[model samples]
Target: MSDSPRTILVVEDDNIVRMLIVDVLEELEYTVLEAADAAEALAVLNNADQTIDLMMTDLGLPDMNGKDLANRAREIRPDIPVLFASGYADSVDVPEGMHNIGKPFSIDQLRDKVKGILGN
Candidate 1:
């Protein structure tokens, strides 16, 4: 609700994928925070000076799954939107209202998903 760019926390173990996501989001004028694991994402969420608008994380992480990360994030920021990115979408059953996009997603697809989630 503030007059600032919306922030998105991206968590992925794969460095290339993480970089791609961050680059795409940043190109779209979003404030992106990157983390390679759940612990790092949690640290960002817990200490962030600004509110994160959404969390777009890979489904499988090195330490924890995306669903668990989202649950933990909600505890810290109840209203934060979650967008799960996974190659195995059929395996992930997120709660209703949560957004998700499959792996190998194009930039436009990612952009649309993020915009929809943020109501842009």
Candidate 2:
């Protein structure tokens, strides 16, 4: 019921994977922001002008892990939904209501998971 399209902040260090995810989310009719590392992600989260509806990050990042980033992002936007993506996601301790989709996911898999969180 929001007037603006839902916005997602995608954090992935892998260039190709990040691009693919961005493309998929855009096709799903969501506005997207992206970062290649935790620092950039933090900067975006710190921005007072942007409204991020959700965060989808790779579990393993070069600067800092996705969980930590999510924690920090929560400081900026409490209750922001989080989605983690990784091959080893089984090992992650995800927050309640948080979601995950493994790497190499099909377009449908990605769409379902993101739309489920965004409620689109």
Name model 2 segments beyond 4 Å from true: none
At residue 9, candidate 1 shows an lDDT of: 91
lDDT of 2 at 60: 92
- Across 1-102, the per-residue lDDT of candidate 1 in tens digits comes to 576888899999999999999999999999999999999999999985867889998989999999999999988988888999999876778876678898
lDDT (C-alpha, whole model) for all candidates: 0.90, 0.90
Residue pairs with backbone overlap in model 2 = none
Question: How does residue 7 of candidate 2 score in lDDT?
Answer: 93
Worst 10 residues of 2 by lDDT: 88-97
Q: Candidate 2: how many backbone clashes?
A: 0
TM-scores, all candidates, are 0.94, 0.94
lDDT tens digits by residue: candidate 2, 5-100 = 899999999999899989988988899999999999999999989988999999899999888888898888888999999897777778886888
| TM-score result, candidate 1 | 0.94
With candidate 1 superimposed using the best TM-score fit, by how many Å does residue 10's alpha carbon deviate from the native?
0.6
